[model samples]
Target: MAVIPVAIAGAPYEVRIKAGILAQAGRHCRPFVRKNRVAVVTDEHVAAKWRATVEASLAGEGIASQWLVLPAGEATKSWAHLAQTVDFLLGQEVERKDNVIALGGGVIGDLTGFAASMVKRGCGFIQMPTTLLAQVDSSVGGKTAINTPMGKNLVGAFHQPSLVLADPLALDTLPLRDTRAGYAEVVKYGLIDDAEFFEWCEANGEKLLAGDAQAREYAIARSVAAKARIVAQDEKETTGVRALLNLGHTFGHALEAETGFSDRLLHGEGVALGMVLAARFSARQGLMHGQDAERVVRHIGAVGLPASLRALGLDCDGRRLADHMLHDKKMDAGTLPFLLMRGIGQTFLAKDVDLGEVAAFLDEELAA
Candidate 1:
């Protein structure tokens, strides 16, 4: 198992990556578990596939657990589900000192973590992310939240997990569409600053999707390490260093909002398309050569991800879509900082972005 440490100030955690690590979850989690019992919050899809292994592992360590399995989907990330999760934890008699295991994809992790942060004022939680997307991105960072009518993750807290067990074998059972969505985040790390890694991704992305264990592990480890370093520096994103992590999120979130956060466009899919838009917009702003944008679009497209907004076929124009970003969480003093690129592996946050120009630019993109 490879352990990547996230050394955020006053709250450090470890993200463990390996194949078949699920069976040894008890042994791996023994140190941080404060009580002999834990409450596991998961979605039905994940519970069906991974609950037995997780429960057996805990039982092997003589640890007892209670589980709350929710419906599977982005809809699960809401006030109703949040209330359900918190109430379930309370009913399980979980204490502030006991750990609550978030044993599913991003939805479960976000809802459970946010609940743990709110329960008894604050409680301990463990992240056992099952999907590639969760394992690579959402599982490590302390950011936790459920979507509100206002926006995606507009209401979340920074509650880091005590331990994260990411068993890569989980991806073996994921649907191809879901795996491809997760790959978008994987590519983001490369586009953010690791050009060579992006090159590696261009070479291995298909293999990773085809169940290449070695390739998958390498990508996950590299992405996790990159995020860990950033989170350590700016845990709360106060320094904009961590903002680099939002490479494609601004436009991506707008796509998500336009889609009503539905399955019509997955988060990673929107991000895949959003990164392409960012790259092209960078070229338009004279921050980089148009070839760089084309390269990004080509690499992401080669992986079967949607690299253009036109692929989504929304009945809206770019200006309407751009209006959605007005609700972005990154907006401060009415100035939203956009993450743009100078070249592959060279991304920077730009606050001088004019939303009107962005709308006009999108009008051109949608028309294209």
Candidate 2:
């Protein structure tokens, strides 16, 4: 078991990673859960797989679990489901002092955490992220949100989980395509500032995707530690230090909006292509070497992620895609800050980006 500490000053917590941790969920979550009855929020797909095991574990600890299993997908992260989840928790008589469990992937964690944040002013929640994307990225950072018609993650709050239990055994049930998509975030840490880790990924990413237990644990622990250090420094993203974490997200979110935030392009798939675009765009502006940009594209393509915007076959023009970014949460003073790379490990936020120029670049990418 690898325990990574998220050192947020007032709400420090631990992300415990291990194989079969979900089977021992009750034992691990005993301290944070206060009452005999606990409310667990999950999705229909996840409930069918691990729900019984989790229920049995909690029962062994003399706790009764009330469950709210929602329909699965990005669409579930909406105002409608938020109200539903909040109502369910209220129906269960959850208190601000009590902890509820978020027992699925990113969708469950985001929705449940946001619901917990609003119930009775605020309440604590536990994160049992069952996906690689959630385990490595979304589950660790205290950024809980739901997608709005305007954009992804536009309406939400910073509600930290009391504890995060990531079980590698969960991935054994995940589809290979979903696992590969989640692996994109794992590669993001390397692209953010850890070139050596990027090299490690170049060598071991295939093995990690192939279900190597040691590799999965190491990658999750390392990614969590990196995020913990950043979150501790800039909890609210007021400082630019935390912005590094959004290296591929700005562009990725735009792509998601373009695709209507549907299964046509998974969040991680959008991010994978976004990182490629960021790199290639960096190279186009001479901020990074062309060879370095191609390297990023090579790794992303090798991993079977979408590395080319042209291949998406979108009928919209570049201007329309850039328009989607106008609704981005990071838009400030009529300018959107872009994450561009100087190299694999060198990402910086550039605020002087012109959307027209970005449209032109996208046009070029779309044409290429």
Candidate 3:
């Protein structure tokens, strides 16, 4: 088992990664789950797979388990769904002292954590992420939210889970597409801070994707460590530091909006394509070389992730995408800052940029 500690300002947490950790959840959760009743918040998909193990564990700890299954998709992470989840918790007599455990992918984690954060003003949240995406990225950070019609993650709170239990065994059930999408974030940790890690990913991503045990554990631990450091520095995203974490999300979320945020465009795939565009745009501005852009695109494509602007199939051009970015929740004072790169393992947000130039550049890229 790999125990990764997340030293954040509000709370110091840990992510436990192991092969059979799901079966040992009760032992791990013994401290926080004092109340007799615990809600296992999961989606239909995950509930189908790991319900037996989770329920058995909680039951062994003398905690009654209530399985609250939501629909499995980004659309379910909304105010209405969240309201329903809170209602379930209330109906189950889930007191604030008791804990709510999220047992699925990012969608389930985000929705359950948000509900747990709101109901009775606060409750405990434990992440039992089942997907590669959740294990590597979303499960660590406290950023929990549901999408609004205007944009993604518009309504949410910073609610950190008391514990994060990442069972790599759970990811075995993930679809190939979802697994590849999750890798995009794993690669991002390298791009944003560590060149050595990035190269390691380039060398071993194939084995990791093939479900090699050591590869999975190493990638999850390293990715968690990278995110832990970032969150510790800037928990609320007020400083420019946390925003770097959204390296491709600004463009990626807009693309998701255009696609109705469905299976038509998975979140991580959009991010993969978005990162490619960001790198090419940076190269175009002479901040980085074209080869760097190609390197990112090549590796991502090699992993079966989206590698080009055209692949997303959004009807709009770059100017239109830029316009959509204007609605991004990250915007402040009518100026949108972008995380642009100077080279590999290097990216920084530039706020002093003109939208017209960005729009023109997008138009040129679209025309090209």
Candidate 4:
């Protein structure tokens, strides 16, 4: 087991990673779960796999779990489901002091955490992130949100989980495609500021994707520790320090919006492609070497992630895609800050980016 601490001043918590943490969830959650019965929010797909395991674990600790299983997918992260989840929790009589469990991938964690944030002015929640993407990134950051018609994660709040229990064994049940999508986030930490870790990923990412337990454990621990350090420093993203975490996200979110936030483009897939574009765009702007940009594209492509925008076969023009970014939540003062790379491990936010130039570059990329 690896215990990484997220020291967010007033709301410090621990992200516990292990091979079978889900099976031992009750033992770990005993301190935070005050009631004899707790409410668990999950999606239909996840419930089919791990619901019984979680229920049994909680039962062993003399706790009864009342579940609200929702339909799975990006669409579930909406105002409709948010109201449903909040209503379910209210019916369960959840109190602000009580902790509810968010069991599933990013969708469940984001929705449940957002629901918990609003219930009774704010309640607590536990994160049991089953997907590798959630375990490494979304589960720890407290950036709970739901996708809106305007954009992804446009409506939400910063509601930290009381504890995060990440079980590596959960990946054993996930589809290889989903696992690969999750791996994109693992690679992000390396691309963010850890060139050495990026090298480590270059050597071990295949093994990690192949279900090497040790590699999964190490990568999750390292990524969580990196995020914890950043979150502790800039909990609200007021400082540019925390904004560095959005390295591939600005571009990635735009891609998601253009794809209609559907399965046609998974969040990590968009991010993988977005990182490639950021790198290539950085090179185009004379901010990074062409060779360095190609290195990013190579790793992403080698991992079976989407590394090319043209391959997506989108019918829209570059201007239309850039228009989607206008609705991005990160937009401020009528300007969108772009995350561009000077090199791998050297990402910086560039606020002077011209959308028209980005459209031109996208046109070139679309043509290339």
C-alpha TM-scores of all predictions: 0.98, 0.99, 0.97, 0.99
Model 4 regions more than 4 Å off: none
Sequence-dependent TM-score of model 3: 0.97
Q: Write the per-residue lDDT of candidate 4 for residues 1-368, one digit (tens) a residue.
A: 89999999799999999998899988999999998899999999999999999999999999999999999999999999999999999999999999999999999999999999999999999999999999999999799999988899989999999999999999999999999999999898888899999999999999999999999999999999999998999998887788888877877888899889999999989989989999999999999999999999999999899999999998888898899889887789999989888988888889999999999999998888
**lDDT digits (tens) for residues 1-368 of candidate 1:** 78899997787889999999998988987776777877888988988899999999998997887888899999899999999998998898878887889998888999999999999988989999998999999998889999999889988899999999999999988899999999999999999999999999988999999999999999999999999998898989999999999989999999999999999999999899999999999999999899989999999999899987777888898778888998998999989999999999999999999988898888888878
Candidate 1, superposed: residue stretches over 4 Å from native: none
Error of 4 at 145 (Å): 0.9
Model 3 scores what on Cα lDDT? 0.86
Best-fitting candidate, measured by lDDT? 4
Whole-structure CA lDDT of model 4: 0.93
Candidate 2 TM-score to native? 0.99
The pairs that clash in candidate 2 are: none
In angstroms, what RMSD does candidate 1 have relative to the true structure? Answer: 0.9
Model 1 residue 19 CA deviation (Å) reads 0.3
Off by over 4 Å in 2: none
The lDDT values for all models are: 0.91, 0.92, 0.86, 0.93
Candidate ranking (lDDT, best to worst): 4, 2, 1, 3
Query: Taking the tens digit of each residue's C-alpha lDDT, what string does model 3 give over 36-96?
Result: 7788888888888999998888889887788888888888988889899999999988777
